[model samples]
Target: MPAGSFTMGDSSGDRNRADGETPRHQVALSAFEIDATTVTNDDFARFVEATGCITEAESFGFSAVFHLAIDAPPEDVMGPATGTPWWSGVKGADWRHPGGRFTDLEGRGDHPVVHVSWNDAQAYCEWAGRRLPTEAEWEYAARGGIDGAKYPWGDQEVDEGGWRANIFQGEFPRRNTGEDGFPTTAPVRTFAPNGYGLWQSVGNVWEWCEDRFHPATYRRGTTAEKRTTVTDPVGPADGQARVMRGGSYLCHDSYCNRYRNSARSQNTPDSSMGNAGFRTVSRRGAER
Candidate 1:
């Protein structure tokens, strides 16, 4: 994507107000090229086959999976995970077996690889000779050159044009009607590309960004004199949770409506889940 300036954060003030989606600020970024799609199972498989790298999920012997999508045995499904009753920690859940031990990459090789932590994404980037897009770069690229737009494709509601992206439909947690033609994850390139030729930058799977996360990261310059135009901001210098952009397949309007371009979420670098994945970027031009 070409370098440009855009006002970052929730201009609509419609979603994730308290989750650091406010204080829409002007941000300028340099030219960079991002992967058109999130890293797919097929792409990650090649990396593993060449390096024999073991993902954190595989090393831990378990990963988080949505309750409704858990295909593991009753014993392997270790109930819900505290406050998030919708998510459960399942044994033998990894990228290869997304649903659980019983599941495999039968027809889902083209889908975004899940059960990948930020560290795992970094490892993949290292192996592929690329890097995760910084939070600023991500938002800039996600906007597709459309400043202040709620989504990659414009401010029209996600479902306003007949299932623009893959996200939870019908009910949340309890049931998904698959009104978007996907109950869980859709293919990496299932939707139309943004103006910059980027695909699924809003919904599908949460793409990890290369920045430490903090709810107050945006507030640093909110005070008057310091509130000048930030050029290529890199988020907080230190934090336990890394940034995750692009809401996942489980996102829904009734609950987690964070699938917008300015929406932000975070998780520990070692944490892995079925709803998360990442794409890579080339900062020094489009070499990849």
Candidate 2:
């Protein structure tokens, strides 16, 4: 973690949705340590080899598979699979089998491991002697001293002649030319790191925070969100789902741009998909 303050919401010039990221407020965070990149296939493999931890997606026997990896033609692609057939409920899909069918993490050991749920992430953190950062800490570290800029890099458009992060570049759900050097997910740290030396805090995948998802928690709550200032603001006690930050490769400006620093979303703790993964944080004196 890095000690700093940022505007903590969408700026005045931002035309994005103003619901979750409204009334830009000041946020301060203390120094902490976050993973240089998301836990990759190789990283998770080490944990699995040691602990024999089977992820929920692996134990449950099915995980969400991106439609792009399916055999369906472009015209055959349908609605959101998590709702419709947009995601294939493939057997054997887990951190090892990203696509669930015949795909494996064989040659792509550096790519960020997917199909991990909140429970899975927490278990990994415990095994690694770290914990998930709160939503506030995640945002603070993600800002990278830019102070409330739209993205981890800055407010400039993504294609401003530099590789800022990995996300959908072309028209989504139809064509992806891989102009960003990746159509799905580039390897973790495929691009540059933020000012604090944090990697992939904005794209590649949406990381799970320790906080619970609350629609108005930031505005009206007795817990972490409402407190004016604190050392480490953990989220609410209970909720339907956990908070997810730093949107995923599936994020698109035309659709889900929650990849922005202020943007947020959530899912059930047990739900695992290709677009959701996580990183861990360690306190100053905590065991490494």
Candidate 3:
């Protein structure tokens, strides 16, 4: 992707906006080369086979799975968390077994690898000689050369023949009607690419960025500062969780409407779930 500028977050009047996405400000970024799609199971498997590296989910022995994905008894499959029961901690649910003990990545080699924590993503990036995109760079690339466009496709309705992105349909958690032709993670590049040729930058799986999560990190600049754009701004210094941009398959207009380019989310660095994955970026000037 070439160097460009765009607003980093959502505006005040932006519908379905979250508190963290306030104080929309301009961000400038230099040219960088990002993965066309999130790291897939095949990509991660290659790294794992080469180094015998085990993921956080493998060490933890379990990761979060959507309730609908786990069909067995609660005692057999791990129980769900009290706060958000939509995500059930299913035993044997690592990146290899995305749904639970019953599921495996047999034919889904090209699908984005989920149940990967931020640390796992970092390790993968290091092995690939790349790094996770900074929050600014992620949003800039996601915008696809269209400044202030709601989505990577530039303000197109998501349900226009469901050609936009893979997201939850019918109902969330309980039932995914698969109206978008996907009840779970779609194969990377199932949809068309953005202007920058990046695939599923808005939806599919939420991507991890190299930034700490701060609800309101991009402060509203004083009049003078507002006129000036921030260049490659990193997130705040102090925060427990890292930032995750874009939304997951569970995102829907009825619930989480975070598929827009400016949307944001987060999770602990060690937290791995079925809904999250990541892409990597390499600086253009770096020797390949």
Candidate 4:
């Protein structure tokens, strides 16, 4: 367990944006243990073999596939491909089958599992004697140690003398040079761990947290000058979509840069796509 306080949100940097991560504020948290890495295919496979869990995407018979992977076929692929032609809704594209029919987790056992919805993640957590981290807990862990720093390692744009983290390294949508050494999700723990010894907290895949999305929730405060500092902030009690954090390999500066520690995004609890996956967290006293 690592204990520390940090000024949550962007800390005034070139990548910092206004709208969501505004009015950066200080937050303190007690020591807690987070997963060392995102849940990998091997990890999920173990859980499935032990508990016989079937993911929601698999039950639905279809899941979101990246445009590039979807379009790689010989043009005879059969499925309800997205009209956008970029994001194809391919059948059998669940966690086991990532890029539709042809793709499999065979050689990529260490890769983070995808196509997991909030409910699916919760189920896994429950089975593992753990739970999804709240948005506050997630952000606190992702912030590592540097107070208010933009990226996980610090305010520095690049990894220590190297391009760290898996993100789009070239033009978005059209071309990706794979300068980050990966086009899609890299193996879990491919990058260095944060101060808390947590890995892949900033990129790889967006993680689901225990919170609901509300644009106005950020503004609710005791007074106009200061917003209420919540203890173990659980976000709004009820809402349509749940919060997702840490962004994913799909994140790009030209499009979505939500991989930043303080950034927040959301999707329906029932919705599971290729870019979304999750990790589990357990309380200190909980049986492990």
Candidate 5:
């Protein structure tokens, strides 16, 4: 990606005010190299094999999986997560076994690796000599040079162009018709590339960024401080949760409609879920 500036948050009325996707501001970013696709199960498997790194999900003995995607036996299902009835904690859910003990990464090696936490993503980045893109960079790149657009492909509805991205098509939490050709996650490179040649920038799985989560980060006098363009802005200095962008395949307009370029979400550094994954970026402009 080349050095450029863009409006950071949601200005288009379609934002979730509670998620703090407001008070849109200007952000300037430097040239950086971001992966064209999110890290796949095969990609993470290589990292794990090379470094012998155990992900938080594996160490914790449980990870969150969508209710419909859980393939574990009744005994292995740890029950639904608090507040989110649609998500259940499974005993053996990890990147290698996305659903549970009954599921394996047999033919889904090309799909984005889920059940990864911010810390786990960091480990992979360290081993690969790369880093997660900052929230600003992620949004800028996600826009694919089309600033202020609702999505990476610009304001046409997600389903307007023949299921542009992978996301829940039917009713959420109860049924997914797979009208988008995927109910859980599609291949990392399943969608068309954006102007920058980046695929699946918004829908597929939420991609983690190198930023601490703060609802008011866009507020004046908060992080950026000034109203003018802030060059290479990172994020808040400290927070309990890390930022995650690009809503997952579970996103739907009837419910969690956060699949836009400016939508934001967060989770603890060690919390892993089946709908979250990440891509890496090289800070060095000369590196690819």
Candidate 6:
């Protein structure tokens, strides 16, 4: 992609826009190339085999697994998150064993690798000689040349015809109708690509970006101040969490309607969960 500009935040008029998404601003980015798909278990496995790297979740001894996906005994499963009880911190859960020891990536090698943290993603990027996309680059590529569209496909009517992306189709937490043909992570290429040939740009799994968390990064000049473009912008210089975009399978319109192209959220750099994964990008002049 060539250098270009686009709106980079949720619109104030959008009822679904959160307070953090305010002050929608223009962002200018340099040319870059991002993965058309999230990194898959097959992709990560090659990295691990080459580098002998262990993901943070594997080292920390746990990763957040959706309660509905847990197959182990209740006593063996780690407790749920403080506020979101639907997320269970399953022991032995990692990228290879997403639902804990009971689960494996047997026939699902093509699915997006979950249970990965920002640190883990960086490690893989380092090993693969690629890097995570910045939040701006991510949203820019996600928009697929469209301006401020709600989704990669520009269709707000989710699952109207059929499954466009992997996400909760029925009641969340308690039940997943699997109308999207998946209850957990679907194959990386399950959905049609965006205008830019990017698949699952709005859902399937939350993708980590190379940016620190800051709700106000896009807050900028008004009529009183000169307009400026945030050229090839990076995120906050310091923060406790890193940015995650494109929502996840667990997201639903009833709760987290964050599957929109402009939607974003954050997690600690070391935090890993079954619903999160990432892709890689290369600078325009860099080797892939």
Query: lDDT tens digits, residues 170-280, model 3?
Result: 866678888889888999988888888899997789999998887767763313467678876777778899999889888988778888888888889999999899999
Q: Write the per-residue lDDT of candidate 5 for residues 1-288, one digit (tens) a residue.
A: 888788888956888877788788888778899999999999999998999999999999999999999998899998888899999989999998999999999989999999999999999998999999998889999999898899998999988858889888888889999998888889998969999989999889999999888888878323545567777767788889999999999998998888999999999999999899999999563221
Question: Which pairs clash in the backbone of model 1?
Answer: none
lDDT, candidate 2, 1-288, per-residue tens: 546665666673443443356545566666788888888889988998999998898788777767775533333333355444556666666777776556677778988888999999989988998888888888888888888588778887767877778888777767766778887778887788888788889878989988888766555433445436444556667788899999888777887777788887888999998888888888443221
Model 4 poorest 10 in a row by lDDT:
71-80
Candidate 2 accuracy as lDDT: 0.76
lDDT of each: 0.89, 0.76, 0.83, 0.75, 0.89, 0.83
| 5 versus 6: better lDDT goes to | 5
TM-score for each model: 0.96, 0.88, 0.93, 0.89, 0.96, 0.94
Order by TM-score, highest first = 1, 5, 6, 3, 4, 2
How well does candidate 6 match the true structure in TM-score terms?
Answer: 0.94
Please write out the lDDT profile of model 6 over residues 25-73, one tens digit for every residue. 7778778878999999999999999999988998988888888888665
Q: Which sections of candidate 5 miss by over 4 Å?
A: 220-227, 285-288
Clashing pairs in 6: none
lDDT-best of 2 and 6:
6
On residues 1-288, what C-alpha lDDT tens digit does candidate 1 reach at each position?
A: 777888888887775755787677888778887899999999999999999999999999999999888998999998899999999999999999999999999999899999999999989998888999988899898888888998999999988968788889888879899988999999988868899989899889999998888888888745564456888777777789999999988998899989999999999999999999999998463222
- Prediction 5 TM-score vs. true: 0.96
For model 4, the stretches where C-alpha displacement exceeds 4 angstroms are 13-19, 71-85, 225-228, 284-288
Off by over 4 Å in 2: 12-19, 71-85, 221-231, 283-288
Go through the candidates in order and give the C-alpha RMSD of each one to the true structure. 2.2, 3.8, 2.5, 3.2, 2.4, 2.4
Per residue, candidate 4 scores C-alpha lDDT tens digits across 71-138 of: 33444344444544556677777898888767888789999999999998888887887888877778
